[model samples]
Target chain A: MDSENLENINQMLEQDAELREKIKDQVTEFDKKTRVMTGLLNKIHSTPTNQLPALLDSVQPVLYSCSDVTAEIADLVPANQFWRWKDTWCNSLRNAVFVATLIEFLRSESLMTIQQVSDILGIQPSWKDRFVLTAEDYLHGVISLVNELSRLAVNAVTMGDFEQPIKISNFVKDIFAGFSMLNLKNDTLRRRYDSLKYDMKKIEEVVYDVSLRKLAPSTRDA
Target chain B: MAEQPQTGSLKSRTAIVVVFETFRNELDEHNDRRERLIKNSRDVTNLSKKVIFLLHRIMTEDEPTPKPNNDRASRAAAKGREKLKEVQNLFASIRGEVEGDRFWRYQRNVSPGLQEYIEALSFAHYLDTGALISFNQVQQSLSDEHGVPYFPLTLEDYLLGLSDLTGELMRYAISAISQRGGRTIAREVCTFVRSCRADFETLTPYYKELRKKQAVTSQSLQKIEDATYAIAVRTSEYDLPPEMLDDVVAMVSGS
Candidate 1:
């Protein structure tokens, strides 16, 4: 090899190693934040429906810390390499979105929008930086939220919150309708969306069981 | 499109919704293009495999005996050429759908097929001309039939494919070892593989996949050397006297 070629190879090797090390650090930070968010979300899963707001409030500090680390990751990753590392960082954001949306559903009995989740997570709309999460990433997060809500609907009936299942059933069906309008080609997201129908079906079953027995919230509360 | 939301939350909500709608459209188009490219490339890969099989048959039937009128091997070579043409056509269809940045994005989908085709084409070229096919020759053969710009195969794909071509050459060397001029063929292959290994070492740092392949290429070169050494030892056993036998063995083994 020529001396020029040898010099070029040396430079490239150094650059590749540096980029890999930086990405590893960012991925580690993202993983740590994701763990905190998952821990908080698990608490919501076990907490009773009526006491969800209080449970969420207790984890408020952790939510801010998770988002802070996410922002740091966004700043650290270069724009061009974002696609390669997207699955890693977006997975972390997906967990955060899942928990934030669940907290929103419990508090207002309504669907949480992407903007709301971003607000909850303290994520800046880093459109110019371009390393921040996209709406599509949050959509994936919402898809996971739909899956969790289906299980929540069944559990709510057992917890004597029959009315919550009705709200969840409606919210999930609405999200499914919105998703169906999109021409989705991402196989992973498409497959996940296909299972939304099953979640809708399960929620419907829970709603039917509650209604037929007059065990719904309106009747019991009255 | 009714638009009356001036509040910060509502404005950002609208933006997110609009962005997602655009993103979904882009994803749909990208997936469609990717799937189409993969389908065409797989056809190319299958055809290329058939071409390699034909080449293997041709080599197997080629013997030193006076059966020079054996039409079957030539017929198989002819059929392999036709299959290679079909591969070129299939690749043309893929090239039509992808260009510029799209080519780079979908490269991973078609790279394996392209590399396999390269191995087959190079093997066939070597058999016919007793010369290594150049990258320019591969490019010229793949010229677009539709009068469009010729699709140039990326150097990365070509080099990767050429690396795999060594494995095919290794297989050929192993089978030819029992025939006349077999040791020479094995020696030539060992030299070629060693040169390829040296060329790739300079490129390894830039490509992680290439680094892995270079390691495999080194092992392949070693195997060819070992095979030739066995042939030399066996040949020397018959021609040399006991005192001279040890010296001949040492020379062959050292080389």
Candidate 2:
């Protein structure tokens, strides 16, 4: 056995470890920004529904900084190897996407498309680029959105915002219905999709309670 | 309330459905490709295992001397090469699925088969030339007639596959040790495996799975050392000629 052959392999592996370390640093920075954005978004649960637009506006600076960190992370990844180190930063990226989607939802009261999330993150949505956001990440973000909305539905009622729960219940149900259309394999996405039903049920119960008590002025009100 | 806004209007409801419909098609395509890659990868693994088995069978079937140009060894090498062609074809068939970025996307699906192929290739290489196969050599075998690789070989897979080669070499050494001129080959293999272990130790921290494979490599090296040690002690105790001593030992061991 030539010692040089093993030496070459060792060098390549060392290079990979070094690259991953740099990516991890950027990902940690990205996570910090998303955490701040999440903190700001969490305030939506307490604020009156009329003040959500102001809250969403206030989160824009952190979102832009998060996108900047994402760009730096993207530069660190080699071409055509996004998925190679995807696992290292996948959770943070998903969290960032969830934050973006939630803000979009609060702003427009509709689902944010993958393209929209990509636009906000300043990365391509297509896999042609190594730094692109994948469809799985987008879908996982949407699923997280569903979970967060369910919690928001309960909190909205606690804040004496009866109509907000109705809107959340209807929005969650629509997203859940959309998810049922997907033929998900037995993967993380499938497991998350399975749990989506519980969130849906929880939102439905909130809506059920509001309607039963006649707290909501109109079920048709958003 | 100033004005309660309607969220799930007929327009927005239809829009969400359309968006999800697109996501559905995209996800379904990805899932289908992934499934195909996984099934093909498993097939490759099976064929590579067969190649490994065939090589082992050929090398052990005849007790050839340690000479590099021994006829039985060449014949074994030729037969193993022919069998490995099937495994290579299996890889070539799935080349398009893993082309470009898709390769990285589905690398986990492809890695098991690729590593197994490396193990088989390196084992055959060692048997033929009594040397470790270089990463470039393995990648060369995986390339097309035009010299373009079906997909780039990852360093992780290359190293992992080489680590697995130690186990095969250990088995080969043990099976060959009792044959004519087998002790020399066994010692050569032990040296090679020990060197491989020492080299791979520096890399274990970079790859978690490689660390696990290193543990197995250590075990394989231990087995080879113990077998060679037993043979050495037995030979030292015997006063007969080497051939007669081999027969006596074989009989005592009930082989």
Candidate 3:
């Protein structure tokens, strides 16, 4: 019986090693896609406001690629084990959401609705996709988007798009109101929410600074 | 026909917005439920730790012959029981939300607390009944306490809690031995731990963390074994010197 127990332990150790290797490979692929998507996002960030459409077009394919990689990762881990691995890929998903919101900001000058973001990524909004995105993932993505938009509001003023700060302020205020309606539990989401108040203040200050200088976009566009 | 298709597209867009709104509401509800569950579970974990400390204190070094029925021990046990009842009430409050798919949402938050509470409950049970508490009994008690038909004590939590129980038992054995030559208690603890180690062997394959806990359990069992062995050898050779107790304990634990 002792020998049998030893054999079982040996077998489990071997299986554990194999499982880790398999997960590492999938995570690496997921990381690579996120890095590429983030690179494209940085490019969009630096490009002038008028040049965003072309940059967005270039970034769309990479977004699709990220969705595919995320799907693969969801498949690689057993459904029961997804929670254990969820943290591993959350940053990438957050970045993906940032891109989605950036597209919304660039095109519509409003917060990207979750449905539109899901449509953009070609993923389902519900966990029914099992191997795709869920509402929490989307929320985390939106949370990250809020953080980015606050910085973008400041940067847009530096780029002489003074009206962008005001637009972002309103949009972020709307998002913040929407977030406040929901009680958050996930540690990362809650931490992000706490920072959102500061984001709101930062964007408000940018709008204040722009108005003080009377550098609002209208006269320049006129 | 073209007008119909345009209106159809418009209607679907409205539907998408409606669907997204419902999804958002659901997410908010889930987050609220999850936060409450975590807060309650953390309270349970803290309360259960106090229960554990109480149990540790109640465990006598050289259990008296007539078992003087230590007043302090009984009082501590009663306090532990009351805290457990509060934990049950907390679970009952969340039980409605924990149905269907929502259980997994709160599982991670509540699992640690559940395990700690189980350890406390099982330790209390051993003190009361002088036997290991069965998993089925634990579930039944929880269900009864909450007045719920079904309880969600997962098998993993039960096993993990049982493994933690062994660590407490090891401490008990060491304390008992130091007081008044508790070879009998130590041997009994060894036998119980050995069976637990064997029982966990089958489960180690499914849970990575369980394997680590099992390794710790084995070491705990070994510690008791070596301590008992040293106690026996030292007794046969010479009176256990009070000054050498620390060295003997350190040497036994190290080996």
Best by TM-score: 2
* lDDT agreement with native, every candidate: 0.70, 0.83, 0.69
Model 1 chain A weakest 10-residue run by lDDT: A1-10
- Specify the CAPRI tier of model 1: incorrect
lDDT of 2 by residue, B1-255 (tens): 222122332225556666677779998888899889999989989998998998878777744344443566667778888889998898899898988778888998999988998999888888778788998898899999999998889888998999999999998899887576688778888899998998889878778999999999999999999988987897888687766876776779865
Give the range where candidate 2 chain B is weakest over 10 consecutive residues by summed lDDT.
B2-11
Scoring the B chain of model 3 against the true B chain gives a TM-score of 0.78
Q: What stretches of model 2 exceed 4 Å from their correct place?
A: A125-127, A219-222, B1-11, B62-69, B237-255
Q: All predictions: root-mean-square deviation over Cα? A: 8.5, 4.6, 9.0
Q: How well does candidate 1 score on lDDT at residue A137? A: 78
Give the Å shift of residue B160 in candidate 2: 2.0
TM-score of each: 0.63, 0.90, 0.63
lDDT of 1 at B159: 71
Model 1, residue A12: displacement in angstroms?
Answer: 4.3
Q: Which of 1 and 2 is the better model by lDDT? A: 2
Give residue A209's lDDT in candidate 1 (0 to 100). 90
lDDT of 3 at A217: 59
Please state the CAPRI-style docking class of candidate 3.
incorrect
Write one digit per residue (lDDT tens) for candidate 1, span B119-213.
Answer: 89888766665456676667777786544544546667877887787788788778767544556667777777777788778777667788888
